[model samples]
Target: MDQPWLKALHVAAVLLFAGGLLAQSLAVAAALRNDISPGVLARLRQWDQRVTVPALLTAWAFGIATALDNGWFGAGWLSAKLLLVVALTGLHGLQAGALRRLAFQAGRPPRGLGRAPAAVALALAAIAVLAVAKPF
Candidate 1:
């Protein structure tokens, strides 16, 4: 399709993916303190599997499409943005694993996971700057 629409979809998908990761991060952090019900964790897992995962995949697909369409493959800013996106994606996987462990097994989340939300925020901010400014 058109470049503008493609970019818009990519942005929308990224927003959804980022929102999901933030929500998951908070939930995992909460699990570290209070006892979140297994049912709630299950619901979160369902949401992650159905909505968040798809959104992440969509974001990747549309992002690559936009980059190809714009011939931005070699841009330094794009590379930096992609690195942040990969980090976010990996963070999502870790969060999902933590949620599963919390739901099925007993114990606190892995150390340092409580700080993931802030990290996600920072990465997202950096990504936004790179995307908007394209500053190398």
Candidate 2:
């Protein structure tokens, strides 16, 4: 049996990770609009590198561990959740790369990158609903 505390921790981490991604998306959207201060953009890049990256790694570790412990392989819903997680992970990578370019390169913000966050956000919302409903 999985420890209750471990399950709780995993859920909390998931919420934090998802919420952080949403917040980061909004921040990127804001930055994309109108000229933002160099300091602000630089700080956002730094935060992504220093904080968001680590948090995402930790969240994935915990989430995967919890799923495994809960017999995720036996559940269709769990499999779907894992797939969505992978998609979100890809989006996270794209976001990180975009931030790096925005901070250091003089490029056109990498065309179509802006769509990733919204896509991930929608996927996440669907994932959340699936998790809650477990309608598999």
Candidate 3:
């Protein structure tokens, strides 16, 4: 309920989202060469459904809570950070789609998706800068 604890939980959610995305990205990349093994695909699906998705939702929920709690919704820097968060959310959607496709792959899973994790990393870095510096 307190601001500090709420912010800490938001950060933890962000970290969970990032880690899950990283693992999913790597797994998808591996699937590009060959069909992901059923076992691996199952695990990946479970992670996506149970962990990754929930973490992302939690991050968004807590982020909005923090922003409104602290009266930060109208700041220029927050707008930029929100844009980056949208980007991250879009990437998350695409990754989820790719993972779904991987589940149905007969062979030769999708390629050119290896860049997703890197993009997420970049987005996260930019968001961190905006949050810390609020330079706008």
Residue 63's lDDT in candidate 2? 70
lDDT of each: 0.91, 0.71, 0.84
**Model 2: per-residue Cα lDDT over 1-136, one tens digit each:** 3667666776777776776677666556665764566677777777766766777777777777776776666688878887898888787776766666667755545546557568767898888887778788
Candidate 3 wrongly placed segments (more than 4 Å): 106-110
TM-score of 3: 0.88
TM-score of each: 0.95, 0.82, 0.88
Rate residue 60 of model 2 by lDDT: 76
TM-score leader: 1
- What are the per-residue Cα lDDT tens digits for candidate 3 across 23-115? 887777777766558689789889889998999999999999999999998999999999988877887787778878767763444566766
Ten residues in sequence with the least summed lDDT for candidate 2: 105-114
Clashing pairs in 2: none
Using lDDT, give the best candidate's number.
Answer: 1
Task: List model 1 lDDT by residue over 11-119, tens digit each.
Answer: 9999988888998998998888875787888998999999899999999999999999999999999999999998899989989988987887866788789899899
- Extract clashing residue pairs from model 1: none
lDDT of 3 at 90: 82
What is the lDDT for 59 in model 1?
A: 94
Name the lDDT value of residue 86 in candidate 3: 89
**Global Cα lDDT for candidate 3:** 0.84
On the 0 to 100 scale, the lDDT of residue 130 in model 3 is: 97
